[model samples]
Target chain A: MVKGKTLTYGVLLGSICLIGAGIYRNEVNIVLKKAVNLCLECIGIG
Target chain B: MDKRILTQIIATIAMNGNIKGFFEGSIFKGNSKKLCVPGLNCYSCPGALGSCPIGSLQAVIGSIKYNFSFYIIGFMSLMGILFGRLICGWICPFGFIQDLLYKIPLPKIKVNKKANNYLKYLKYVILLVFVILLPMFLVNDVGMSDPYFCKYICPAGTLEGGIPLVLMNESLRDTIGFLFAWKITLLIITIIFSILIYRPFCRYICPLGAFYSLFNPISFYQFKVDKNQCTMCNSCSKKCKMNIEVYKNPNSMECIRCGDCAQICPTKAITKNFSTKNL
Candidate 1:
């Protein structure tokens, strides 16, 4: 039962992610690019 | 007894700005200083003398308003490595509020034991996807301000940080929009839930707590278990608000080092030792 609950939660969280991605694809990409740049900048390469 | 006093003293020092000028909001001149402090204390909070590192990190990476802040990360790492989750348990003003809230007379609900273990991982997901990854990638520039945690989550930021700042700053009040209202709504929900649940944010949401848990096993301050004095009565687990089995795993990720287990140990087996030997 516990394993089942965990699986359910995993599916639910995954679905949320998928939906979020579908709705916010461009926004997510913009954020991701900025994040990558920040990380690179942190290492003094950006 | 002395430990609580020490914790209180440390909290006082951090709050009152006695030891260093940094604690009094004097460190970073610009907005970058606002992006540090791993704990949830909001930088804009009237009482907060220091910065909220998570908020700052998100803002630096997420918004089109700021630049990347190396100083914030450096400051946060210094605190994280030095005391780890100790701040979450002791120093954080928001943590203090939750501790006070749990004192109210109510029927406390513990998460189902079997399902509880999995809940510990949620904070890590929040840390990765929301706190770190999202801000870094979502912004127009590498150093733009996002405050992603505050915008999407972070009841503390909403309550202690956001509300007060907006109230005090007329300029912020004038610019309030749908996003601010959304955050305020999240804040209200969290506040209401916190009154009934014991450290709800710490248990299931805080990204900072997730970071600190990674260091718990190796952090200088740790809970030591003496197996010889074994009476597996489960009393310690019962006393825990975080719903962790203290005897089974005293240093478990969910263990907030609130000292309930140490205080209730019938055999006096649990001890919180602040030494690098464990590391």
Candidate 2:
């Protein structure tokens, strides 16, 4: 049970860390650029 | 007052777009829009100070040139691990709207467990198809793809961003077409269902909810049923708004950690936060 619990926690946390590290390599800026747009088509206005 | 009310107020205010632009029906174009809020808020909502995570995710995935969003995935992963679908119960603007709508006096719709289980799978399908596959594969000549979920579904965006924009701007009114009409129909149906059912969207259509549900069992902040104290009288299960059998599965993906079961538990058998009960 302890091993199972540890494995779950470890994998989840590890993936989070890996993804977190990748964010600095331009993922945030790219998302931010898109987000700043009104995305008129998204709300069916365009 | 409920903690939910307080969180709702804070989230609303925090996400509230610029008041002048909001009243003028202009979506915020500020740098703050770059940030993603944890819950399902529409970025184009005139009052929205931050971006919707799902919208941001779709936009990133649907970009002409694919750029996987490490930032969004990481942020959401962290949130899921920390709180799971408690974000639905406590922080989501759309979920708050549903909660208020459900509180209105109306005949309710209660699906049987078997049907409910089947419906729960819909959101996962939406996540898989609309958010992921459609955007990833169905690209235009320029390689950009539509954020299909936002374009076709997501009543939240229609409610928060669509109706307001049309009401506030004469020019945008002319832009409304079959797509807008379709979204309006979806929005109206969602609102009516919310009044008659407990979070119908959360239970069956919200891809974001589906994403968070995946982490409910192992999430750090959720509830557990104390086997010692639980007498299996079914009081907690009855109190659940999400229709979960709390005693049988305190950590069920459907359990939103709303604390209703905890408040009503006859033997005080429910406890919140991390614990060995999950193990």
Candidate 3:
């Protein structure tokens, strides 16, 4: 019974995080792109 | 069969983009743009399907143009309240690796009981000084980078995330210098020590784990002590890899919700439930 509950919560939380990732995909990409660009800049590549 | 082994296999497949590859034309690029996972897996890792929360936090915090990241914080809070350190035990790929490493033959060191109390606080210090405050304060106009943890400390970023990516990309290999070599060295050291020590990263440094731990006692999923059924056998503590005295406080910051104690308990005393208190 407890195992079932734990599994359910895990699945629910995992799905929420995944869905949130889907929704925020562009923003996250923009930020990472910028960060990577900055890293390249720091290394004198950009 | 060990449940952790099953979890590890599943997580590895999920992380490797096997699941995501089914939906997307290519696994490598599709998941790279997503939000970070709660654990320490790096965003740049070839196999990673999502971003790394700590890396994202550091990137945003360290950014010269941005002052704050509501997205990262909100995501972190969501994970914290929902599962607490359970994420560390169950979801984290690095944690799964550590579990496998500890299974190898070695002289396992049990940390001193008195010293253990003090050591748990180290992660909080790392979070405050290294992760948040330093990045917020240290930057000139150019902005600080990912701070001391990723650059100097995080072996997960070094191992599972760094080495494989660098090895795969020849352009990245050509670009590697002293810093890359240093990180590789740190990774090697961590892998060697992890064979004998249980989660040196989780115990000493992981800021994400530290943040989630603060919510452990009050999280939706928590350990409940029946109090009556406990036989005082100390069996639960003996089985716990996190070195927590489960009976004294099952919802301790050190408790990773691995379910080891619950499964091992002779009397079936420890259980998980929703916390009613604000603690």
Best by TM-score: 2
Residues B1-279, candidate 3: write the lDDT tens digits: 778678766766676563433333222455354556667666555556666777677777777656456567767877887888988888888888888898898889887878878888899999988888877888876775545566766777666555654555457557777777677777788787788788877887789999888768667788876789998899999998888889998989888788989999999999876644323
Q: In candidate 1, how many Å is residue A34 off?
A: 17
DockQ of 3: 0.10
Instruction: Give the alpha carbon lDDT tens digit for every residue of B108-225 in model 1.
Output: 7667877667877899999888888877776643455455665667777556545654655555567667666777777677676787888888878888788777656555567877
Best candidate according to lDDT = 2
User: Candidate 2 at B62: error in angstroms?
Assistant: 1.2
| Segments in model 2 whose C-alpha atoms lie over 4 Å from true places | A18-22, B274-278
Residue B11 local lDDT, model 3 = 68
List residue ranges in candidate 3 displaced over 4 A. Answer: A1-46, B18-27, B274-279
| Candidate 1 - chain A - TM | 0.49
Model 1 chain B poorest ten-residue lDDT run:
B25-34
What CAPRI-style quality would you assign to candidate 2? medium
Query: In terms of docking quality, how is candidate 3 classified?
Result: incorrect
Span of 10 residues, lowest total lDDT, candidate 2 chain B: B64-73
lDDT winner between 2 and 3, please give it.
2
Which candidate do you rate higher for DockQ, 1 or 3? 3
lDDT of each: 0.61, 0.83, 0.70
- Models sorted by TM-score, best on top: 2, 3, 1
